[model samples]
Target: MEKEYTIRELTKLCHETAQEKGFWDEKRNIGEALMLIVTELAEAMEAHRIQDQANFKEELADTFIRLFDLCGGLEIDIQEEIDKKAQRNKQRPYKHGKIC
Candidate 1:
Protein backbone atom coordinates (compact mmCIF):
# COMPACT_ATOMS: atom_id res chain seq x y z
CA MET A 1 0.00 0.00 0.00
CA GLU A 2 1.10 3.53 -0.64
CA LYS A 3 1.91 5.75 2.29
CA GLU A 4 -0.13 8.79 3.19
CA TYR A 5 1.09 11.92 4.87
CA THR A 6 -0.64 13.68 7.68
CA ILE A 7 -1.06 17.44 7.47
CA ARG A 8 2.12 18.02 9.44
CA GLU A 9 4.06 15.56 7.32
CA LEU A 10 2.95 17.19 4.10
CA THR A 11 4.03 20.53 5.47
CA LYS A 12 7.41 19.12 6.34
CA LEU A 13 7.69 17.70 2.85
CA CYS A 14 7.08 21.16 1.45
CA HIS A 15 9.72 22.60 3.75
CA GLU A 16 12.29 20.04 2.71
CA THR A 17 11.54 20.59 -0.95
CA ALA A 18 11.88 24.33 -0.43
CA GLN A 19 15.38 23.84 0.93
CA GLU A 20 16.31 21.99 -2.25
CA LYS A 21 15.25 25.06 -4.23
CA GLY A 22 17.18 27.39 -1.93
CA PHE A 23 14.30 29.45 -0.64
CA TRP A 24 15.41 32.53 1.25
CA ASP A 25 13.19 34.96 3.10
CA GLU A 26 15.19 37.86 1.71
CA LYS A 27 14.36 36.92 -1.87
CA ARG A 28 10.65 36.17 -1.45
CA ASN A 29 7.76 38.00 -3.07
CA ILE A 30 5.31 37.12 -0.29
CA GLY A 31 2.83 39.87 -0.98
CA GLU A 32 2.42 38.89 -4.60
CA ALA A 33 1.86 35.21 -3.90
CA LEU A 34 -0.55 35.98 -1.08
CA MET A 35 -2.47 38.36 -3.29
CA LEU A 36 -2.73 35.80 -6.02
CA ILE A 37 -4.16 33.14 -3.73
CA VAL A 38 -6.50 35.58 -2.08
CA THR A 39 -7.74 36.65 -5.46
CA GLU A 40 -8.26 33.07 -6.58
CA LEU A 41 -10.18 32.21 -3.41
CA ALA A 42 -12.34 35.27 -3.73
CA GLU A 43 -13.13 34.62 -7.36
CA ALA A 44 -13.79 30.94 -6.81
CA MET A 45 -16.05 31.58 -3.88
CA GLU A 46 -17.87 34.39 -5.61
CA ALA A 47 -18.40 32.72 -8.95
CA HIS A 48 -19.06 28.99 -9.33
CA ARG A 49 -18.25 27.57 -5.88
CA ILE A 50 -17.13 24.54 -7.92
CA GLN A 51 -19.64 21.91 -6.82
CA ASP A 52 -17.73 19.21 -8.67
CA GLN A 53 -15.78 17.22 -6.07
CA ALA A 54 -12.74 16.48 -8.22
CA ASN A 55 -12.49 20.06 -9.44
CA PHE A 56 -12.76 21.38 -5.91
CA LYS A 57 -10.00 19.11 -4.71
CA GLU A 58 -7.80 20.22 -7.61
CA GLU A 59 -8.37 23.85 -6.79
CA LEU A 60 -7.63 23.23 -3.14
CA ALA A 61 -4.47 21.37 -3.99
CA ASP A 62 -3.32 24.19 -6.24
CA THR A 63 -3.90 26.65 -3.44
CA PHE A 64 -1.83 24.63 -1.01
CA ILE A 65 0.91 24.08 -3.59
CA ARG A 66 1.13 27.83 -4.09
CA LEU A 67 1.24 28.27 -0.35
CA PHE A 68 4.08 25.77 -0.13
CA ASP A 69 5.92 27.72 -2.79
CA LEU A 70 5.36 30.88 -0.84
CA CYS A 71 6.72 29.23 2.28
CA GLY A 72 9.78 28.11 0.34
CA GLY A 73 10.29 31.55 -1.12
CA LEU A 74 10.17 33.00 2.38
CA GLU A 75 12.63 30.37 3.62
CA ILE A 76 10.29 29.34 6.38
CA ASP A 77 9.92 25.84 7.73
CA ILE A 78 6.22 26.36 8.21
CA GLN A 79 5.52 23.33 10.38
CA GLU A 80 8.38 23.95 12.77
CA GLU A 81 7.72 27.64 12.81
CA ILE A 82 4.09 27.20 13.56
CA ASP A 83 4.87 24.72 16.30
CA LYS A 84 7.42 27.09 17.86
CA LYS A 85 5.05 29.99 17.64
CA ALA A 86 2.27 27.99 19.20
CA GLN A 87 4.52 27.04 22.09
CA ARG A 88 5.56 30.64 22.57
CA ASN A 89 1.94 31.69 22.53
CA LYS A 90 1.12 29.08 25.12
CA GLN A 91 3.87 30.40 27.36
CA ARG A 92 2.58 33.93 27.06
CA PRO A 93 -0.78 34.91 28.45
CA TYR A 94 -2.72 37.39 26.38
CA LYS A 95 -6.41 38.12 26.75
CA HIS A 96 -6.78 39.25 23.17
CA GLY A 97 -3.75 38.02 21.31
CA LYS A 98 -3.88 37.17 17.64
CA ILE A 99 -0.28 36.23 16.95
CA CYS A 100 -1.21 32.85 15.61
Candidate 2:
Protein backbone atom coordinates (compact mmCIF):
# COMPACT_ATOMS: atom_id res chain seq x y z
CA MET A 1 0.00 0.00 0.00
CA GLU A 2 1.05 3.56 -0.52
CA LYS A 3 1.82 5.87 2.34
CA GLU A 4 -0.60 8.64 2.99
CA TYR A 5 -0.01 11.99 4.67
CA THR A 6 -2.03 15.14 5.12
CA ILE A 7 -0.65 18.48 4.08
CA ARG A 8 0.22 19.33 7.68
CA GLU A 9 2.01 16.03 8.13
CA LEU A 10 3.99 16.52 4.94
CA THR A 11 4.93 20.02 5.98
CA LYS A 12 6.25 18.77 9.29
CA LEU A 13 8.16 15.97 7.64
CA CYS A 14 9.70 18.24 5.05
CA HIS A 15 10.69 20.85 7.58
CA GLU A 16 12.15 18.27 9.93
CA THR A 17 14.19 16.75 7.13
CA ALA A 18 15.44 20.17 6.10
CA GLN A 19 16.39 20.95 9.69
CA GLU A 20 18.18 17.63 10.07
CA LYS A 21 20.14 18.40 6.92
CA GLY A 22 21.30 21.70 8.43
CA PHE A 23 19.31 23.75 5.95
CA TRP A 24 17.64 25.50 8.84
CA ASP A 25 20.69 26.05 11.01
CA GLU A 26 20.46 29.77 10.39
CA LYS A 27 17.58 32.12 9.81
CA ARG A 28 16.55 31.44 6.24
CA ASN A 29 16.32 34.16 3.64
CA ILE A 30 12.65 33.94 2.70
CA GLY A 31 13.27 35.45 -0.72
CA GLU A 32 15.97 32.92 -1.53
CA ALA A 33 13.84 30.04 -0.33
CA LEU A 34 10.95 31.13 -2.50
CA MET A 35 13.26 31.52 -5.47
CA LEU A 36 14.49 27.99 -4.96
CA ILE A 37 10.96 26.73 -5.24
CA VAL A 38 10.53 28.75 -8.41
CA THR A 39 13.70 27.25 -9.74
CA GLU A 40 12.31 23.77 -9.17
CA LEU A 41 9.24 24.64 -11.20
CA ALA A 42 11.41 26.08 -13.94
CA GLU A 43 13.33 22.82 -13.99
CA ALA A 44 10.06 20.95 -14.28
CA MET A 45 9.07 23.17 -17.19
CA GLU A 46 12.33 22.43 -18.95
CA ALA A 47 11.94 18.73 -18.30
CA HIS A 48 8.49 18.84 -19.86
CA ARG A 49 9.83 20.70 -22.85
CA ILE A 50 12.45 18.00 -23.35
CA GLN A 51 10.01 15.14 -22.65
CA ASP A 52 12.00 13.92 -19.65
CA GLN A 53 9.06 12.40 -17.79
CA ALA A 54 11.06 11.13 -14.82
CA ASN A 55 12.85 14.43 -14.25
CA PHE A 56 9.67 16.42 -14.76
CA LYS A 57 7.95 14.46 -12.04
CA GLU A 58 10.93 14.73 -9.73
CA GLU A 59 11.17 18.48 -10.24
CA LEU A 60 7.48 18.91 -9.53
CA ALA A 61 7.94 17.03 -6.29
CA ASP A 62 10.93 19.25 -5.47
CA THR A 63 8.75 22.30 -5.97
CA PHE A 64 6.19 21.03 -3.49
CA ILE A 65 8.89 19.96 -1.04
CA ARG A 66 10.39 23.43 -1.08
CA LEU A 67 7.02 25.10 -0.70
CA PHE A 68 6.02 22.81 2.15
CA ASP A 69 9.34 23.43 3.83
CA LEU A 70 8.86 27.16 3.57
CA CYS A 71 5.36 26.94 5.01
CA GLY A 72 6.59 24.75 7.81
CA GLY A 73 9.50 27.06 8.60
CA LEU A 74 7.19 30.09 8.63
CA GLU A 75 4.43 28.33 10.60
CA ILE A 76 1.91 29.11 7.89
CA ASP A 77 -1.30 27.11 7.72
CA ILE A 78 -0.97 26.38 4.03
CA GLN A 79 -3.83 23.87 3.97
CA GLU A 80 -6.20 26.39 5.50
CA GLU A 81 -5.03 29.07 3.12
CA ILE A 82 -5.51 26.75 0.17
CA ASP A 83 -9.01 25.84 1.34
CA LYS A 84 -9.94 29.50 1.71
CA LYS A 85 -8.56 30.42 -1.68
CA ALA A 86 -10.30 27.46 -3.31
CA GLN A 87 -13.60 28.51 -1.76
CA ARG A 88 -13.12 32.05 -3.02
CA ASN A 89 -12.15 30.79 -6.47
CA LYS A 90 -15.27 28.66 -6.63
CA GLN A 91 -17.35 31.84 -6.32
CA ARG A 92 -15.62 33.53 -9.22
CA PRO A 93 -16.94 33.69 -12.78
CA TYR A 94 -15.31 31.74 -15.55
CA LYS A 95 -12.02 33.40 -16.53
CA HIS A 96 -12.40 35.74 -13.55
CA GLY A 97 -13.74 38.59 -15.68
CA LYS A 98 -10.76 38.54 -17.97
CA ILE A 99 -10.93 38.73 -21.77
CA CYS A 100 -8.78 36.45 -23.97
Every model's TM-score: 0.54, 0.96
Global lDDT scores for all candidate models: 0.67, 0.96
Off by over 4 Å in 1: 5-28, 43-50, 85-100
Pairs that collide in candidate 1 are none
Clashes of each: 0, 0
Model 2: how far is 72 from its true place, Å? 0.1
Could you give candidate 2's per-residue lDDT for residues 1-83 as a string of tens digits?
98999998999999999999999999999999999999999999999999999999999999999999999999998989999
